[model samples]
Target: MKKLLSMLCALLTAIGLPGCDYVNVKELQPGVSTAVEVRQRFGPPQHEWRNEEGSVTWEYSRQPEGAECYMITIGRDQVLQSIEQVINEQTFARVERGMTPEQVRRMLGRPASSQYFQLKQETVWEWLMERGSTLNDPTYFTVSFNPEGRVVGTGRYTKLRP
Candidate 1:
């Protein structure tokens, strides 16, 4: 009976808090870890950037239904330089029209998901954030990028709940 009760409690907790999964920030060791290790642990990066100085940046994100989204900047030498969280209000405010995907990714990490419209020649990236009044319902911060990968516009939408 005790074992059954323990299992029931765990199941209830998991189902009740779907987005509260653990994201161990300490696992990322800047300046000591390699790009390959980062990829192996976190899976594929959702976005990547190559700077003029030859350094590269990779962003991995989990939002609305997950803990955090962060960026790991790797130098030209392939060593990790920085691990920064990019999921917050200040970051969202920085997104503006005409910004490059690289610039936006640096601020907001990877979006939760994206959609490409071939006929319109545009891509829409969406981030799910908890900014609405309801606790369970989240709002989406969307940025539309042109074919050239520049931000063309942005918008916000709230999820409807019954």
Candidate 2:
């Protein structure tokens, strides 16, 4: 059953339907949309961050299949502040050595996957990126962390999708 569901999701994503419940952010108004409306559209968020000023930002990740991660911020007055896609090249450039996993997650939402290399004592987190116009290959942005959980480096690579 799980395998069937996974395949179904992959098919939907491949056809350009967003994997995150097919969220349509275009219909949502920034300052006019209510928290209730946002929740109704996107479903419950994967994680929520409360700002120092009392605003909240919710993360909706469509990863390991789809290429976008959204960060929707709601103001203290309960109005939607802004909707941002955080998995682009700009956000990837912000990741630096010595940054913690929490920092990376906050900047890029959640990664698509993570792997631990026992021999190298390193952990790598990868986020699948949107394919460029010139290539249909799968591209990934990776952040490698040392055993102490601090980022050591960042990388980008493309893989030919089968």
Residue 38 in candidate 1, Cα distance off native in Å:
1.8
69-162 per-residue lDDT for model 2 (tens digits): 9899999988899999998988988899999999999989889899999998999999989655455788899999999999999998888765
The all-Cα superposition gives candidate 2 an RMSD in Å to the true structure of 6.6
Clashing pairs in 1: none
Q: For model 1, how does the per-residue alpha-carbon lDDT over 1-162 read when each residue is reduced to its tens digit?
A: 755644454454345432322332455578888887666455566678777898887766666465367777889888889877666677778888899986786788767788999998999988887645546566788899999899999887877888
By TM-score, the best candidate is 2
Candidate 1: deviation at residue 27, Å? 2.4
Sequence-dependent TM-score of model 1: 0.60
User: Looking at model 2, how many pairs of residues clash?
Assistant: 0
Clashing pairs in 2: none
Candidate 2 regions with alpha-carbon error over 4 angstroms: 1-23, 131-135
Write down the lDDT that model 2 would get. 0.83
Cα deviation in Å at residue 76, candidate 2?
Answer: 1.4
Please give the range of 10 consecutive residues that has the lowest summed lDDT in model 1.
16-25
